[model samples]
Target: MWFNWLTALTKGVLLMAIQIVTDSTVQLTAEELATLPITVVPLIVRIGNQEYFNDGQDITNTEILTHLINDTELPKTSQPSIGQFLEVFDRLGQNGDSVLCLSLTHFLSGTVNAARQAADMSATDVTVIDSLSIDRGLAFQVITAAKLAKNGAPLEAIIAAVDLHRSHTKIYVFLNTLENLIKGGRLSKAAGGIASLLNIKVMGEVVDGELQVAAKGRGKKFLNKQIDAVIDDIKAVSPAKVGLTHVDNLTTVSEISQRIKAALPETLVTIHEAGPVISTYTGIGALAIEYYTD
Candidate 1:
């Protein structure tokens, strides 16, 4: 059925079909993956001596959170191996299709580099894009590329559209604790300890592919005010979609979702649990909001 749709759309105009590929960091459910014309390569997550794939099926964000809470060692995530990328590329291009692979930000992960390296070695025609963002922010670009590809858009057109979506997207994360940051070496132990002693909650935003501290304060009220400010910022733009992702913080994410929905009722809104790869850095009680504007 999907092949028929592709054939009908590209019948006389295109030489070959375009295939979409992305890493597991993108915020998409198993059902969404099943229905969408896209392929995902899973990231590897290791907790202590155990290794799990961030494929949503083999491992879940909840299970990762449990280990994060109970285990002493911080979880570590690795990008899919070059061989993994080659496998997907070779399989997808078996029918002479062109593959477009999107990966999480280079600053956060080495996935894009690996994809590019694999593309060089594989016989298939493959293009790799560094998404420059993660979670739903990355999904905005990947899903847009998939939709355009499915509709028979040319490779250049799909890349252009994806870049446009990327420019229009913003991601903000609220960190509940600094323990992960310290353990992951994103923040110094001294700084994290000082912040923890003060009970500070940090707000960070993804900018130019790097996470930067945007704001900080103590308590829920400060976070609420910051969220309201973000809503106000959203009102200033023509928002297309808003996503809320949390690491074991449904209550807070739900409230944030409600606030966004109330402000932009017509815009598409979705909520997801952050995957293991993301949870490894964000830790428990973190909430991330991804905003895509038209």
Candidate 2:
């Protein structure tokens, strides 16, 4: 189905896409990036990175591929600026279709506001939604939007579903360090300053539209306890769709998945490497589990 879509997207045709900047799926090569119904925004997207876009085998550029293979990783920037997002909205407008953008948590980043600004000026119709969550946290919302657009669902309906689900979703996380949050300015001075004295570890979940701490762990072993809390919370909600994501730590993801399976075998759980943008705050050991419980 993905391959078919690529074939259909001929001649810089306008396309409907779900743009997300999370720890996982963000660094995919342009070819890898474009394969999804998604547009992966890096922590930083450079001016010339578009040259390597691999729309398909026929469209793949050897020079670009060569650069990609030789370079350690793609260069990224802060969440795309409002002007940058406008460019994408404008281009898609040429194809006579709107874009539905699913963004990471608003509390976590300013990316949503930037996207809204761009959409306001876009010639095409654009709906920017705040996932209000992170990790694969936003995956289902993105997937549904993409699927709806692919199946010719009206832009308005697609946007509505995205909005509805964004409100329904919940994200739970276990942070290995408050250092990442501190650096990202997420942790208050009281929280970060006493990180050492408190020997801080953060275990939190989003409920009623707020990031609230459920517990604090002092070290690695204690993180398991936090995971236990997460599982218990999930059990109470029993979401139909679920995912586990880690910034740079696949190890933690594996460990959590096994636990989730044991605790909630009926739920579907997907594991993903965190994309660069999300990692900026979540840190290497940052792990998040998200699902829809209602």
Candidate 3:
């Protein structure tokens, strides 16, 4: 059911049609969305009494950062409802087009589960994929699938290619503050307080669909060393694409981008601001490095 065919009357031919769908956590620009054959379903972010759709257009990351810095209540994010996914799937598959829906890791969110439920309830042939990643890490896979679909590749080939890319992709995050973690109940208040008093920074990696802290140290020197290590690792792999995403941490992210470009001139590098759902958890001054190897 993953593959669907449509008849073309021009030459009496049968052509394969596939549609790419993903949640808004994937870091794609407006231009990319307009140009690519990909559709995004948005998550919801609630701060106090106001609710915002995380589609970038409904609420900008800048506004989210300001609220996080000043608001008393921490922002809350929710996965898109099954009905939302069902609507998208139904529309895309209305004309005999099979749909490929990729979602954020279920470890961090229930988006994949919602997508799966919607896929089952819909009449269309829908395949839901747990990307096992977020942001640019997820975007890389979505873009790859869209490109393959546009070229009329078979469903199996698209899935295999996406799997290969996912295997080679790596995500590393540096948390400049532990306040969000503590507020979100991910870290104990006592532990976060101690770390904050010592001005500690946390370096984490996304592995097996979960974030695991890899290192912790104090001051700018420690942060620099970790960034250097990440850069060195990227150099070792000679990645095909490097994406830098952050929540209002432009200076540091820009520096890392320059270093990557200098070292890997052939690689494609992109810079994006972390969206609301991501910003809510990352807090201010958080940077994420997404690397995809050849």
Candidate with top TM-score is 3
Please write out the lDDT profile of model 2 over residues 41-88, one tens digit for every residue.
Answer: 433423244421222232222333343335554333355567777877
**Residue pairs with clashing backbones, model 3:** none
Instruction: Candidate 1: list runs displaced more than 4 Å.
Output: 1-14, 186-199
Every candidate's CA RMSD: 3.6, 8.6, 3.2
Put the candidates in lDDT order, highest first: 3, 1, 2
lDDT over C-alpha atoms for residue 130 of model 3: 93
- Model 1 TM-score is 0.91
Query: In angstroms, how far off is 87's CA in candidate 1?
Result: 0.5
Candidates in order, TM-scores: namely: 0.91, 0.71, 0.92
Highest lDDT against the true fold, candidate: 3
lDDT of 1: 0.84
Q: Which pairs, if any, clash in model 1?
A: none
**Compared with the true structure, what per-residue lDDT tens digits does model 3 show for residues 1-294?**
233322232456766489999999999867778877899999999988888899888899889988998988889889999999999999998899999999988878899999999999999999999999999999999999998888777788789889998999999989887777766655566655566556588887889777767788988789889989999999889999999999998998898999888988998889999999988888888999999997
Model 2 misplaced stretches (Cα beyond 4 Å): 1-36, 45-77, 191-193, 207-210, 235-237, 262-266
Give lDDT per model, in order: 0.84, 0.62, 0.87
Point out the higher-scoring one by lDDT: 2 or 3.
3
